[model samples]
Target: MARITAGIATSHIPALGAAIDLGKTGEDYWRPAFAGYEWTKQWIGQNPPDVVILVYNDHASAFDMNLIPTFALGCAENFQPADEGWGPRPVPVVEGHPDLAWHLAQSLILDEFDMTIINRMDVDHGLTVPLSLMFGQPQAWPCRVIPLAVNVVTYPPPSGNRCWALGEAIARAVAGFPDDLNVQVWGTGGMSHQLQGPRAGLINREWDNRFLDQLIGESDALRHIPHIEYLRETGSEGIEMVMWLIMRGALGRTTRCLHRHYHVPASNTAVGHIVLEPVS
Candidate 1:
């Protein structure tokens, strides 16, 4: 059976993707941001997964107010990079694990998660930036991807606990798959940032670091943290961190963290990344 191998958490700032595609990594503003992901690329290069279940939110690109699903799972054979009002980034099209993805979607629904299954959609930076961060400039991504879009942009997004529970469901779903596969679940977005109105550019490195500390072990504390607090302290956009809980919960009761990288001022956001695996 396929086994859960890793869970990754990260911040997916749009500017990070733009910087990568425009060859601006060397620029003063971008050097530090890109620097943090260097070890991530090397880490993944040394230990790559056959499939990655990516958890992220679409930034008003694919599903707008007209249609919003609290949780959506990609079951398509492929996904194209989105042009978020600035043209698509020069990245390889994402290949999906339709077989596993369909199983997961069905299982999640059966488990009472009610996930919306998607067969076709263009992936936004929320889904693609993490790919660029860990895979670097690859002609084609090294493995198949499953895009799980959360409704963080819409008001009243899923609660942190709900996200964590969904992760648990995914864990159960993946563990039951009847295939020999290595799968990784990734949670993207957040590290204390507000990108709108007068509060734009707000960042609380203290809270972010503190949050990271608790995330590894005392995640229950992190889960109970109110959404308003995430909005007030981390910034409205920072509430996206709830998505990280999904990644954490998917890694099972115990995990051995392999790598963690955090940096600030990535175009009005803080960048954080970590890799861990379920420990027997």
Candidate 2:
């Protein structure tokens, strides 16, 4: 059976690539941002998993507001890098693990978890930005990726409890796979910041830190946090932190924090990163 070895949470700030590419890491504004992921990069180098199940939301890139699924799983052989307003990043297309993805999809649905199975789709910065920060643009990705795209753009999306339930379902699905492989699950987005309308550029450091503490130590408390409270307190977009609960639920109740980093003012967002190793 495959064991989930690691869990990671990260913020997918679109401008992060440009900041790194421009060699601005040493600059006052960007230095701390780059510093945050350094420990995660080192850990990956030492213990690279064979597969990664990445959970992220597409920002009206692949699935426009026209049609959105609360939870979509990618089972395609390959996925194209989306051409956002500027253009697609110069990186090799992401290859998916169809065998594992299909198995996960089938099992989750059988378990009564409604998931949208996507045979084909393109991914934007939501997925790529974290990839670049964690692994950089190598000739090819270090491991196969099972992309899980969540719908947070629509007015009403999956609730925090629902996302956490999905995470538990995912853990069971991965554990049941017959293959002998190591897998890492990643939840990307949010640390209390908003983007949109006049409420843009909002950041609540106090709530952000408290959320992180509860996420790692007392996540069951998160289940009680209502959707309206997340919106009102964290900002509409900040509600995306609910996605992190999914990742947290997939790991052991007690996980060792391997790395953590947080920053603000990244194109009107608060960027945060954390890596965890399952505790036995």
Candidate 3:
């Protein structure tokens, strides 16, 4: 059986890429910010899991406001980088793990978790930004990816509990795979900040840190946190933290913390990162 060895959570602030590519990571304001991800870069190089199940939300990129599925799994052969208003990033398209993705989708559906399985889709900065930061544009990505996109755009999205349940389902699916492989699941986005009309640069470090601590040791508590409260306190878009609960729930109760980093003011959003290794 394959083992899920590591889990990670990071903010998908697209500006970070712009900052780095423009050679601003060393700027007075951004130097300390980019310094935080150094540990993550080193960890990935050392562990280098075979497959990375990237859990993130689409920012009105692939799925517009028309129709949104709470949880969508990508089982495609390839995914192109999206052209969000400005332009597409200079990077190769992401390749998918169809076999593993299909198996996981089948197992999850069998386990009573309804999923929107996608055969084709273009990935936006929500997914690519993190990949660019974690692993620069190599000739190819270091490992195969199973992109699980959650819908945090439309109103009345899945509850935190629902997201956590999906995580549990994912863990079961990964464990049931027959081949011996190492997998890492990542939940991207959020740590208290909003992007919208007037209330743009909101940051609640207290809530963000507490959310992180709970996710590591007591995620069950997070399932009960109401969405309205997350929006009220962390900001409307910050509700994306619910997605992290999915990654945490997938890891279950036994996980070893490897590295945790947090920063604020990344262009009106708080940036956070965490890495978890399953304890055998």
- Give lDDT per model, in order: 0.88, 0.84, 0.85
TM-score of each: 0.97, 0.96, 0.96
Q: Model 3: what TM-score? A: 0.96
Model 2 Cα lDDT, one tens digit per residue, 1-280 = 9889989999888788777656666888787788888888888989998989999999887798678899999999999999888888877789899999999999999999888999989999888888889886588989889999988778688888888888888889999999998999999888677777777778887788777777665347885688888787778888778788788878867777877777776767788888887776
Distance (Å) between predicted and true CA of 73, model 3? 0.5
Q: What digit string (tens of lDDT, one per residue) describes model 3 on residues 51-82?
A: 88998999777998777888899999989988
Segments in model 3 whose C-alpha atoms lie over 4 Å from true places = none
In angstroms, the error of model 2 at 272 is 1.0
Model 3: colliding residue pairs: none
Name the regions of candidate 1 deviating beyond 4 angstroms.
Answer: none
RMSD of each: 1.1, 1.4, 1.3
lDDT of 1 by residue, 156-228 (tens): 8999889888888999999899999989999999989887899998989999988777767534677778888
Worst 10 residues of 3 by lDDT: 211-220
Q: How many angstroms is residue 5 displaced in model 1 relative to the true structure, after the best TM-score fit?
A: 0.9
Candidate 1 displacement at residue 202 in angstroms: 0.6
TM-score of decoy 1: 0.97
C-alpha RMSD (angstroms) for model 3: 1.3
Ranking by lDDT: 1, 3, 2
